[model samples]
Target: MKEKLFRWVVKHRKPIIAFYAVAALVCLFLRQFVGVNYDITSYLPDEAASTVALNTMGDEFEGDIPNCRVMVPNVSIAQALKYKDKIKKVDGVEEVLWLDDAADIDQPLATQDKDTVETYYKKNNALFTVTVNSEKEIEATDAIRDIVGDEGAITGSAMSNALATTSTEQQISIITVAVIAIIFVILVITTTSWAEPILVLLGLGVSVFINWGTNLIFGEISFVTNSAGSILQVAIALDFSVFLLHRFNEERGRHGSVAEDMVQSCCLSSVAVFSSGCTVCIGFIALAAMQFKIGPDLGLALAKGIAISLVSVFTFVPSMFVQFDGFVQKSQHRPFVPPLGKFARLVLKVCIPAAVVILAVVYPARVASTSSDITYYYGTSHIFGSDTRLGQDMDKVKEVFGNSDTYVVLVPRGEVSEEQALSNELKALPEVKSIQSYVDVASPYIPTGMAEKDTLDLVEGEHHSRLVLTVTAPYEGPSTFKLVKKIRCIADKHYPGKAMLAGEGVSTTDLKDTITVDKGKVDLIAVVAVFAVLLLATKSLSLPIILVLVIETSIWINFAAPLYTGMHEFFLAYLIVSSIQLGVAVDYGILIADRYREDRVTMHKREALLETMEACTIPVLTSGSVLLISGFLIHAISSHGVLKQIGWFLGVGVSISLVAVLFALPGFLYVLDGLIGKTTLKAHFLPKDAQDPVSDTTEASAADGSAQ
Candidate 1:
């Protein structure tokens, strides 16, 4: 069956090539009409908890709910009040709630007994909360700059349509330029011909379009994020191109004719390439199981992108390679020995000791340094810097507001009949800085002529009530978790069976706690799943164990380095480390294992190991170097601490995995050969009579005669 399929592909190569060319062109043209969306919210399903909460809040609230908050420094209360009217007039703004104004009511307002309104007002900085109805209403952030008008520094909790658009555009631009530059560098290094990487990148460009076009057929989901998806696609697509070229070179070294070599190379490499692609695609597929909407959306996008890359590699790559066959054949080789020989030797000398040191130092260090704080992943620069608006405003707000950390208390109207009583009890809690509720706003001091009242007449009946409390400390670190627990305890004591916390800050804190508790479980599941696949692929229990050790070592080293760097967001780091270790590192193990088995059929065990390392080293190094460099370049465009940490860790991990595969795996294999006592390594299940009979000797003699 395999022989028939191979013969059929060879016979119909021209038509197959033409079909893919047309498909690529059509996809490219269709892409001109498509646009990519990067909104994080887009990843959530319409009914997901976060999305549902946002929608529910949007419906219940009379005014717009601010998504982006701004704080202006060095502004007087009077000066800030003057801009309120101007800010209200800004396009897309639904309402601007200023501290200086209160709407009149027909009924008397209730008064607070705990703290006088005057005292409360004096303690809190006067703030203007501007809210916009939609991003589409205001296309650019210039509208915001216009409203502020260079006046006394203006800042407040405000969502602007303009800012979102600008940020998205900036992110896209950065990713595009970075991907192009990295591809250029990779092309220069791998092919040494200026045109080769260019062609490969061109193929990648086509693949992106194909991915986009096919996604439309699948129903327009959220556009893949430029930062994660676009960059990842380029890196992954290049891997396929690298595999194709590497195999082409291998075939040309044995077969005399470029045309015949192309067919053989495609047949041999396609199996490994497709398998590697499946592993990557499956790594992403695991994201589908994530409860978060973004996780599944990312999974789908990556899965699609991997599929497109596989198709393009099989079709678009082969066409380009065939076109450049003569040029590829003419490229000179210096025949310098691969470093894997020395690396294998070094591994023999140091494998056990290095493994011992890694286990003793790196594993414990990683465990000790793991933290639950998500903000650390965002980095100190992004958290405190004034470059981005969020950073700038967060700094001002933190200073003026004391701490921007907030908590929410939800009360059931069944038990809590009097709003004042609930507010009073919550205020007495040590963690509560200030409370904002309809009941507090309706207090007599807010409307001096009104009398004090215990009940809110306007909002009556069994509706759920909410209290917005500002916490004393910043909403980061271990203390926040403790505060959340304490708040829950306070709620249980006072408003038993009637209250729950529901707000961005509270929900986020809960998520952090949940992730922390489930970290080990999730990691264990992912690792086991990946290991099962590796065992099936290699069909050797010892090999899978060796691969897992290499991967775990890489993950530990990758994670441990962040502790020294002062980067402590363990969850994101763990996700990234695990994914890369499983996806990219596994490819290296497969390459070496496949080569070792192939050589075992003809050579002595030691010679087979050495020759396998020699045959596979260049391709492994080429692919690994490209991935490492591209990942490292992610930091150049992103000041976001999480991205930088990921870039650094992933880059380092890929490089380290390359080293382990070249040294540790070979060393382990040699040790295994010694133990197994002359047992033959099993070759991959290939069809009989499908092997290429061409030899290096025959090709070399033909090349020498041609030169003469």
Candidate 2:
């Protein structure tokens, strides 16, 4: 099958190259038709209580939860009422609720109930819960800004999401350009030909468009997927093209014709690249096992990207190389990396002590990776530039309101007495600062017809009553988890199976719980999956363990570096970086190991190790530097903290992996070659004076081919 693919690629190079070029352009155009969804609640599993309650609230209340909160400082009761009226008049605003919505604003504040007034009016500030039409939130928000002017501040999920969409659209192109420039610089310095890097990037760049165009099948993707997916696809896929081109260059010198050289190189490099790509695919696919849909969304897109990249390298890259054969030959120069036999020995000498020191710090790294101060995890600061008016508005809102969690509870419509009792219980809890229920506005003793219809419907649905509980417990802390558990207990005791809880806090709590377990499962699955691939690729029992250990150690060091800085790391970053770094770094080991296996047949063990390092270091280091630069660029340029942290971890991981692969891997292989020989399915390594059986068999086959 490999030989056939090679033959066909060489035979039909022109058409294949032209088809991919056109297909890439078509995909680029088609991708603009695809949509992106930034609503986090919408991504939750249907069976989750928060998801169900959110859906039910939207159904019963004529819209979803309050999408934006408008803060009006130093406003009179009359002025606040007038502001609410104007907001309601906005085209896409479905509803606006403030102190006046529940009480008569003309009445003295002293006469009104304290709970109702305090809910909307705190100190000299008044707040409005604005429910905007989902499809027109941006337009509605713009209208609100126009009416409120600079004094009024608005912050909420919808506003943040709108900002994120704009921010991502603005920055993705910049990120692409930066990554390409950095990659080009690295390739130019390391490779013999200047055109090689550009050609490789062309294949990867086209593959990114094709991968994104296919997302149209899914209808939409998350904000994270939209932002990070294309860049990551390019970074990972570039390796295959680089590997193939390097092999082709080497083989071209040995073969009589360019076509024959490409065919032989493609057949050998395909098996290598296919195995490595599969390992990465398996690592990404493990993310789908997470119950959290965010993992699955990112995982599926990246996994598909890896598949596209593999196909592109096998088809698109070879065809382009064939077309540019003469130019490529003309463009060749001496590689920048001179032979480093002494450097390889120096690396081996320091390898053991360095490994031992890294092992000592692994525990500290694990602890730092796990510890996070999560109160600010979902802040709106990242939505807009801090220097902008919109950013200032968000800061003002946060300052005035402080960070508080709101939980919406639903229970079967029971005797008004039971609801009144439940509301009292919730209000009495230490963490609960306030509770708004139907009982707040009207007493159960009064007839339903006598109560204001709008006031009655505000907290009462057809079959269920709603209670909005404001809690002081910080998110993702033990207090928050305990508060949630206590509320669930109270609900279960009061209403049995009819009670459900949903809110930002509830959703985040669920996220925390899911990822705590998900981290371990994702790591284990990534290692085992990649291990299986290595085992098949090497046909050696000992090689897989050595390779995995080398990469995992680098990952731990990457994670540990964050502990020195007091900034809290996002929990998802650890799980994702661990799996991804392992998947990515293993390719380096595979490349070196493959070279070592070939070199050992002709050279002594230590001499073979040096030759392997000298041969493999440039490509391995170039790939690492590209990853490192890309990661740091993301860290430096992104407004969102999670993305920045992810980028930092990625950069650190690649740096450490490069060091390990170049230094420790060779040292370990030098010591363990005899054991590797004993366990291998196809042992090829021999001492300096030993005869080679595999080479003899290959020579005999070539002689037979010549005779035929």
lDDT of each: 0.58, 0.77
lDDT string, candidate 2, 335-412, tens digits: 777767777778767866766655566576557555553222432224355665556776786676655556888888
Candidate 1 ranges beyond 4 A from true positions: 1-7, 10-18, 21-55, 72-78, 101-125, 134-142, 149-165, 192-195, 216-224, 253-259, 323-389, 405-418, 443-462, 470-475, 489-500, 674-708
Task: Residues 1-708, candidate 1: write the lDDT tens digits.
Answer: 533554455556677667766777887677556544423333444534334445544444444333333344445555556666766676766665444433222222234232222212333344454555545434313566565544323332222123334454575567678668876765566554556666688778777767766655544344333345666777766777877776776677576655567667777776567667777777766665654444556667777888888877776666666766566546644344434567555555675565555446655655644533223421121222367655555565555555544455656543433556777777777667566665665552344235234334222223555565655555455666677677777777776755566443444554554445445654665567767776666566666677777767777666666556665553544564466556777777777776676666555555566667666776677677767876777655554444555666767888888877776677666666544323324543222233423344557789999999
Task: Please give the lDDT score for candidate 1.
Answer: 0.58
Q: Residue 319 in candidate 2 has what lDDT?
A: 83
Candidate 2 achieves a global lDDT of: 0.77
Scored against the true structure, residue 465 in model 1 reaches a CA lDDT of 54
lDDT accuracy of residue 328 in candidate 2: 74
Locate the minimum summed-lDDT window of 10 residues in model 1. Answer: 375-384
So what's the TM-score on candidate 1? 0.80
Pairs of colliding residues, candidate 1: 70-156, 71-155, 72-155, 110-443, 110-444, 140-162, 141-162
